[model samples]
Target: MKYLIFGSKGQLAQEFINFFEKSSIQYKPLSKEELDVRDLDKVVNVVKEYKPDVIINCSAYNQVDRAQSFPEEAFSVNTLGVSNLGITCKEFKIFLVHYSTDYVFDGTKQDFYTEEDLPNPLNKYGESKLLGEFFIKNTLENYLIFRVSWVYGKGKQNFLYKLNQWAAANSMLKIAVDEFSVPTSTRTIVEITLKALKQGLTGLYHLTNSGYASRYEWSKEYLKLKQVDKLIYPAYQSDFNLPAKRPKWSVMSNQKISKILNTDIPLWNEELKLMVREMDI
Candidate 1:
């Protein structure tokens, strides 16, 4: 199958590239410089030229706080750009595999969120991603959308990477205790995506680790695994006072995907411990 990846330089994009490289899959990776999604004409042209069986969109505007100040930029990439891709994919009869986020939910649910749950994003970034989902769902019939949570691995900006670096240098750390979600590995995400495709499972599904953890709890696990001697303290989200309002609860249920794939997902701490041991961090 011919696979084409957009946003070739993103964190998750890099992971996809690595996976494809090690596999027998043939794919064309396009950076923003190579192909801007907002340029509808160019996007349509690229789709026609590539004639790919699947177009995996790794492109996203992820700056949560900055998105509030630059909603246009976020929407251009997250919503409008996705709309263009969906339009072109629909025209070309290509299966579009897109990634969404758990942030689409407002965290009002006391338990985990399912695919049937209504999305009410609290921040501009979340709103943009949620709209992107709508664009694809409305524009195309052949599409698979996976809503992932707290992705980490082979990325400098992720929580584990930052906390590992900080705990190594600093003696103390202050982490938010309120924010909670399952931390997922990029490798696991890629594997699940491929497996789901093989199983002919297509549609919107919530994908994450089997369990959940708060920022503080997740950080302590990482530090403990790394054997860092940092004195970690608990802090609330209000302590930081960021520009974007966050959902107090961000855990998502992965039962839908798991049931279709008939695969069991590891707990957040289980995955974290494995990653910590596997990597030199």
Candidate 2:
């Protein structure tokens, strides 16, 4: 299928490029400079020119804390930007693949969150992201919305990369003991996307590692695997005193995506080790 990827430099975008690097599929990859989703005319013009069958949007306003101060910037990309794409894709009869976060749902549920759960965003970023999803769901007939959490991989800033860097620099570190979610790899997201595309799967799904971990546990495990010795301590989320409020438990159920893959996802630690091996961390 002919494909177009928005946000070429983003982590998921790079993973998609890596996955299709040697494949025969025709694709046009564009960065923010090449295509700004906020500009409706530019978005429409690009889609009209490419006439792609599938358009994967990896662009988003992902700075959670900063979003509290810049809701307009967040909405411009996450809400209005997506609205532009959704409308254009609908007009062109193109299948849209949008990535979302588990933050849409307040982390109040005791069980793993499914697609059925109603979204109640606790922060401005989550509210903006949820608006994007609503626009796509209302605008397009063929679309795939994957809600993932704690995604990490090469060629971009992510959880694991930040943790490793901090661990290496500090003799001691404090992490949240309450907040939890699957530390999904960008590779995992890319693989599942390819499979879903091949199967023609359309709808909402949660794509993440099989297991979940709190920031403290994930950091300890990552340090152990990397054999990096550091004095890491568990602390409350409030101890950080960040600008935005984060959910205490944002873990999502992967059963929906797992069903399509015909197998369970790899353990977060397993995938973590694999990613570190690739980076020689």
Candidate 3:
């Protein structure tokens, strides 16, 4: 199948490229500078020219704290941009694959969140993403929406990269113990998404690692695995005092996608270790 990918520089998009190249799949990747998803005419024209069967959108407005101050910017990319892509895919009869976030939830539930859970976003970023998901669901039937959490991969826009930067700059760190979610690797997401597409699966599903962890736990494990010697302390989410109000617990259950794939996903820590090994750090 011919594939067209947006947000080519993103961590997830890069993973998709890596997989496609290795598998010798036909694909065309476009950076935001090349083709912004918000431009319907451009997107439609490109779709007409490429004639791709699948459009995997990795583009997003990921500035969580900044989104609180400038919601319009967030909505423009996450909501409006996605809506344009959805419309284009519908018009051309192409399958669309988009990624959402666990932030869609308000973190009130004590258990793992399922697909049936109602979303009540606490911040503008989450609201924007939730609205984006709505646009896709409302616009296209042949679409795959995967709600992932704490995603990290080759790109520097992830928690692992931020942790390394912080460790390099500071001798001590205080991570939030209250906030919790699964740290999903882009590799896992790309692999499973391809499998689902091959099987003709089309719907919304919570895609994440098998297990979950608090920021404190993930940080401790990441630092240990990277062999970084730093003084780390666990604190409440409020201690950092960020602009955006984050969910205290946004762990999503992967049972739905796991059962569909007929396989158990690797644990978050295991994936982290594998990522670090690949990093050769």
Candidate 4:
């Protein structure tokens, strides 16, 4: 089956490209410079030209705090852009595979969030992503919307990369103790997505690692694995005083997808080790 991938330069998209190439899957990867998904006319033309059976959208506006100052930009890419793709995919009868985020929820739930859970986004970034999901669900029937969280991989855009940079720059670090979510690896996302596609699963599901962690906990584990000697002080989310308000407990449950795939996802720390080894860090 032929696949068309958007946002090829992202960590997640890069993982997808690597796996698809290794597996000899036919696909065309496009960067934001090559084609911005917000342009409906261009998006339609590209889909028509490629005629791909599946469109894997890795495009997203991920700047949480910046999104508050630039909601238009966030909505343009995360919402309107997704809407454009959904419209074109529906017109072409193509299956769409899009990625959402855990930020879609407001973290009001005491336990893990499921697919059935209603979304109540706290920030503009989250609002944009949630709206993108709505557009796809309202427009298309055959689509896989995976809401992932705390994603990290080969690129320099993730939390792990920032943590390493902080470790190198300073001997002490302050990480948020209240912010919580599963640290999902891009490798796991790509593998599970492929499996789900093969099984013809079409619905929204929370795709993440087996467990959850606060920013402080995650930072400690990562530092321990890398043998970094930095002293990390646990701090509350309010201490940072960011522009966008974040959910204190945004962990999502992957039981829905895991049961369907019949595969248990690796723990966050285990996946971190694998990623570190793979990156030769």
For candidate 3, lDDT tens digit of each residue in 1-281?
89999999998999999988998999999999999988989999999999999999999999999999999999999999999999999899999999999999999999999999999999999999999999999999999999999999887899888989999999999899989999999989988898899899999999999899999999999999988999998899999889999999999999999998897899999988998898542
Candidate 3 backbone clash number: 0
Lowest-sum lDDT 10-residue window in model 2 = 152-161
How would you encode candidate 4's per-residue C-alpha lDDT over 1-281 as one tens digit per residue?
99999999999999999998899999999999999999999989998888999999999999999999989999999999999999999899999999999998999999999999899999999999999999999999999999999999888889989999989999899999999999999999999999999999999999999899999999998888888888999999999999999999999999999999999999988888988777643
Query: lDDT for every model?
Result: 0.88, 0.90, 0.94, 0.94
> Could you tell me how far off, in angstroms, the CA of residue 17 lies in candidate 1 after the best superposition?
1.6
For model 3 the local lDDT of residue 194 reads 85
RMSD of 3: 0.8
Lowest lDDT sum, 10 consecutive residues, model 4, at: 272-281
Q: State, as a TM-score between 0 and 1, how close model 1 is to the true structure.
A: 0.96
Q: lDDT value for candidate 3?
A: 0.94
Model 2 spans with C-alpha error above 4 angstroms = 279-281
Q: In model 3, which runs have C-alpha deviations exceeding 4 angstroms?
A: none
TM-score of 2: 0.97
Clashing pairs in 4: none
